[model samples]
Target: MSESKALCTDTELFAAALFQLQVSVWERTADDIPVRVEDGGTIERITPVSVKINGIYYVRSECEFRVDRSGIKS
Candidate 1:
């Protein structure tokens, strides 16, 4: 059996929505490589609870972001 936990409370979700908050996601590679910005943008919507599927729990959220073409590798 998997332990269930709430991703976020309803109050927190309301506050985030009310403030129209933003979030930044970072990625780290090897030990020598520094962390880099992967994806970031405004928080459009979020699910307060985690959804279970195939014995796995997932928390989903939506955001508006722009892709940096320069960061793309050939």
Candidate 2:
């Protein structure tokens, strides 16, 4: 399945990243496209942007999820 998400504001950056990013099911693959989440870095900010995964794309909405701090260390 392919998905695409766009960020409306900086707050929705992670939501876009996380949206494109896959969790648990294929956590190991994240090592390749860690671009969304800075390596050894916490989600700082995000701007309205387009993301594509598995030939699919999605738009970030206002309901996107946000984090106060880095969800992961590595």
Candidate 3:
């Protein structure tokens, strides 16, 4: 009998982490968008930034919103 082991590098681990993070961000974004729209906020863009340390990387999500003038009351 023989056992095979797979090795993961830092880059591979970071890539998997990034993918998981992106999925989480997208799920949260899906839930947030409707609420923002209901509150009269316009979505400008969603940006993701990756920060690396010691060869490992993580992602940060930025959601930009614009308020609708018509939805504002004086």
Candidate 4:
């Protein structure tokens, strides 16, 4: 039988599979935008681009694929 586990860690889950999924995102400016490092800076106008997962809770418009295997055990 195969065993399964709920990916409790976002970091681990992203590293394993979520990172590979290219999610199309558009920039929508809002005055109430919260401060976050992944925002890439002020979203002054509507923009669209392909983004990739760069870290546990971070994604970068420019970066390489970094897969995490911590969730998998041998």
Top model number, lDDT: 1
Pairs of residues at least 3 apart in sequence or in different chains that clash in candidate 3: none
- lDDT string, candidate 4, 1-74, tens digits: 33233323445335445334222222224664423234222212221332333433223333222222343455
Scored by lDDT, model 1 comes in at: 0.37
Supply candidate 1's per-residue lDDT for 35: 47
Candidate 4's TM-score reads 0.24
**Best model per TM-score:** 1
lDDT of each: 0.37, 0.34, 0.29, 0.32
* Deviation (Å) of 31 in candidate 1: 14
lDDT of 3 by residue, 3-27 (tens): 2111123443344344332111111
Superposed on all Cα atoms, model 3 deviates from the true structure by an RMSD in Å of: 19.6
Cα TM-score per model: 0.29, 0.24, 0.20, 0.24
Candidate 2 or 4, higher lDDT?
2
Q: Write the per-residue lDDT of candidate 2 for residues 1-74, one digit (tens) a residue.
A: 33433334554555535544331111113354323321122233343543333433333331233232333323
lDDT of 1 by residue, 1-74 (tens): 32212214455444444554433333345664534243334445545443222233334432112223332233
- Clash list (residue pairs), candidate 2: 4-57, 4-58, 5-58, 5-59, 5-60, 6-59, 6-60
TM-score of model number 2: 0.24
Better of 1 and 2 by TM-score: 1
Q: State the local distance difference test value for candidate 3.
A: 0.29
Off by over 4 Å in 4: 18-71
